[model samples]
Target: MQGFHVLVAGVEPTARQSVPQAFRVSEVVALDAAGLHLLREGDGEPRATGLAPLPCLALFATPKTLPLMREARAWIAAQAAAPVPDVVLLDRKSPPAFVERTLLENLAAANAALAGSALRQARRVARLRAEVEMLGAVRAGLDRFVGETGLAQLKRVFSTATPDFETQIELVHGAPLRQVLPVAGTGFAAIDLACTGGKRRGSFVARLTLLEDGEVLAEWRVPTPAQDGWVRLGLPVAHAGLLRTLCLVVEPASEKSPCANLALGAHQPLPAAQLGDARTGLPIAPHSLAFRLYAAVPGTTPPHSADTLMPVAARKAKPVPYALQALPAEDLARVAETDPGTGGPNLLFVADVAAILCRPGAGGRIRAACPAGARGLMASVGVHADTPSAAVGVLGVDAGAAEPALQRVPVSSGGVEEVSLLFPEPLREARDILLSAEAVDGAAEGAWVVFRDLRIYT
Candidate 1:
């Protein structure tokens, strides 16, 4: 009863109301085909009795109907605006061989169209049902507070009372359950620059990889376009448990694209792999890389219990000695190693042409000033040659002073030794310092000296 109702077009209008209920006949139209019919719905519009050429061609078959075929072909070629019948129902008690053949040939198309239409209708019904359910829930919630039976009270409250976070949280939790911490800082340079600049539209492909324990949790290669200076991507979040580390590598789709620098958190100016000119038949590597490490916190939510007792504990902050910098071979000039394969500290010399760079504090480029209460400078040094002796110098820049100061210490070394340059007095304002090792008694040119563990402590 809820489905399509058959409208017999060939039947006379006088017999429309007389049709049996089993036919589900909604309408009847006059036509010349005495034994033919069309199964369709009457949608309150003028219905056509004559069939369109497409349906006509689909209905009749065989050389015996060649004249009728010609007439249908002419009608189709004319392209006249006309109503198309949904189905062709032969009225003959037993269809002729040709008619049966014609129905077999066109049966698949009819079934496919019917299925498609039904699917569309089903989707619309489902959407309407969801909307009605949501509205019911809203009405129930409103009724709880206003003790109202209709939507008028809900509309009045919305029109007069402004909604706020506190009110919303109270409705959700009966009380606020979380605290808000406000933080402010200038964001990433790339994001800030892109926002300030006018948008230029284009799209590129990028890939993301999430890995842990040598297993790939998730990966995606997607195309993104610049819109309003930002390209947004929705990544899968369900695999958060599998992700201990995430790395994103952005590669150019082809060889022609130019490259840009990548910044990771607070670590900017990170050197990236260089991919030379793409046209030169050289393989290019992805230069933009970002990595993050995640750690899972162990805990569980407890059932709400107002009877639980609060525990007391005490904590304090203190400064502990930390390694300022490790002067590795890569950070020094004219560096050589006695046993490079052994993976030990390499030999660095004072005669080196360039002064080795060191951070007396955390991070690069931010120079650490000697603390007013700095106890001494600590270093690890040794001689590899016979007699095992060397002279090391300390270079420092004093606060509020332009000139640099130097102190020398001679080491009669046999094995690796921990040496300290204790300040004659607390260097109240020493800013920065450098250490250089050289042969003391002219033992050899470019004397081999092992250096490591350079630190300053208060």
Candidate 2:
């Protein structure tokens, strides 16, 4: 019979000694209730180390350790990028034969499930590739006759592209936020903000104000909803002159009001914005509130009417053939929250180029506008030179509308691996791409993952 590894937690030494000889048992110290709570909340220490080649079975020998076992299972689920291990509760009085049989059955089931998932993922990737090829052929035929410019014009006319501008990252919350919009065209009307209401019961009012050059232009007050989601405040601007710059501010009625969470984007210089208490006059540099400006057509039947309201483009257009390291310093500042000691994602230099350094359970989402004719994405993942010889980890890549692609890399000290993933369809618009990493089977401190040279390819 082949030997298998089993992890035993909250099991007495005498009980652990009774594990079947066909299994290699490793003991994990049980975390107390407080410690387990903190771990679940992402504030505690890293997982217990030294058990490598991740075990096939996790056994909890006491009912008191049920919470710990559940926490472990939840952690494994959170690492959606990696393989899952089977967790079981073992009764101290259960027979030896019964325990052995149960372990084997569970191991068999887990392996079967993993195999099925892989098959499905593979089939999905194949279908996506086939569809992409078909689309490419069709586009090529059209381009031969109509030409690239004509084709683009046709797509613009037929495409149901909405002019709604919204940010992808909502990392910051609490306090009031403001956005400064640079005005160009005429017929500016209303603004719709992304807001969620709080649970406290009260007659709180949501105050939205529009200001220009230290003068209040327009203001609207609406009762704060007791529910969640976007709250649209109509800005009734009466000015007919060309407005140079407009500042939009959102806040609660009073301090006793229910706290509302307004979604905010990661800070960027353009579309100048701020978030913090307006009273203190000190802005939080991390976030800018989400807002959508609407304007009526100049020659409309009734100027500034609701029926003529169209979403105005607020954000700057992102460049094509997007490269992660090529982003501006201000944009890259919000890329990842780097803290190596706490296992957060970091930015480091790898082979004389900037790369994203991630510990286990750390990852980030990046938003990019895919250029026309873009078909796939390519990236390089590796381990730092200081990594241990036996370090191993998995990197997961997920493009919009496609199944996630996972690569398991074993770095003997320092090694680099290339990862390429094809989009499910030809991408020509903005989309969010997610990158995650996990320490599959290695020393905790040694399993650092480095990602660099990210490129969207044609």
Candidate 3:
């Protein structure tokens, strides 16, 4: 979502200096990637090394400079890549309330199985089932929360950029602006929320491999070939912002994946943020609650309990909790509240503020309409490189950064109280992570949270 360029007509860069730098969540802006002064490669005589329209176009997280560029050395073929830029700013910061469920508590059941020695393996299987059920419950619950909670509206801001982050920061630091197509990360938070607190500038990147004779050519860290291969995109923290969640719209390449390595690296590093507080001088908030959730296995098949998936133990799910520890209270409340209706504080645009933007007597610089449930906003776009389907471009960038302002968010999420999941977005996804809670001192097993008038002003 960061380092974006606004295209006026998909073919030229605009002359306007004060353009929409970034956009709010789901706010579809346009791109103007035409007339971009393409940097030439070589000496005076217009060195024509028989360049073939780049043969392909792909995008990278980093411009393949410095440590990343160096690590990508050896022409060992495309492995993968973040650049140095304005840190992502975590606008809505919130801490997490780790909770557990029945299936997870059954973690103890694995103990008896383990003690039986002969039943150790048996217990392992049972534990795994418990864990599986734990996560399934969490996913279902989270889905429900998002649908029922009003906070889902806040999602419009999720994975979006502010006008400032774009022009003032990104325009000078990362890429150009356009009015055609735009892109962003998936959600917020990371696996290590408990420690560093997820916050980072988002970037669009992919892994690549060069081949000479089907033998891997000049492995350049670029985008999916406008030709072949299964490409994977990644986002790293160029700057700092409390990352709450990250979810790729992942409009897959026209074709499907080929089981194994069709192209990109393991999808593990895609658009993910850094762990621990390396930049910020603060420690991850000591969350009063923390939990882990995982994707459920198909066929209702279960997994081994404390036997192995112990990672959910933090030592295992350690990374996840650390990530959660970095969010804010409002966001945390949204996640912890049992009431799905509590997802968002009934969001309302400050009328006075809205009126100014929509002033019939003023310029059309800003629109007062909040585009939701539509095709999303699609304004001016600058596509340095565009794809017919998804956002994929092969970029060969220069060194140095544009130092854009940041609004970082974590790249991790945890499970609801009882349910479990492989939550990755730090705080943003809290409201969506599935969790199971204990019966309130003899209360019912169901739990929920609620929100009030969420009014936005100037």
Model 1 scores what on Cα lDDT? 0.33
Q: In model 3, what is the error at residue 98, expressed in angstroms?
A: 61
| Model 1 lDDT tens row, 89-128 | 4333433553435444444555676689899999999999
Off by over 4 Å in 1: 1-245, 248-287, 290-375, 384-407, 423-430, 437-439
Alpha carbon lDDT of each predicted model: 0.33, 0.48, 0.21
State, as a TM-score between 0 and 1, how close model 2 is to the true structure: 0.26
Weakest lDDT window of 10 consecutive positions for candidate 3: 355-364
Q: Residue 413 error for model 2, in Å?
A: 64
* Candidate 3 per-residue C-alpha lDDT over 1-458 given as tens digits, one digit per residue, 9 for 90 to 100: 23332211111122111232341111111112221122221333322222112111111112222233222221112321212111111111211111112212222443443367657778899999999999878855543343233222221122221112111111112221111011122231111101111122122221111111122111112222333312222112111222222221111122332111111111122222211121231222221101121222221111112212111112222111111111122232332222334434221212221211011111111121211111111111111112111111110111124321111111111211111122122222111211111111322212221111221100
Ordered list by lDDT, greatest first: 2, 1, 3
**Candidate 1 lowest-lDDT run of ten:** 150-159
Model 2: pairs clashing at backbone N, Cα or C within 3 Å: none
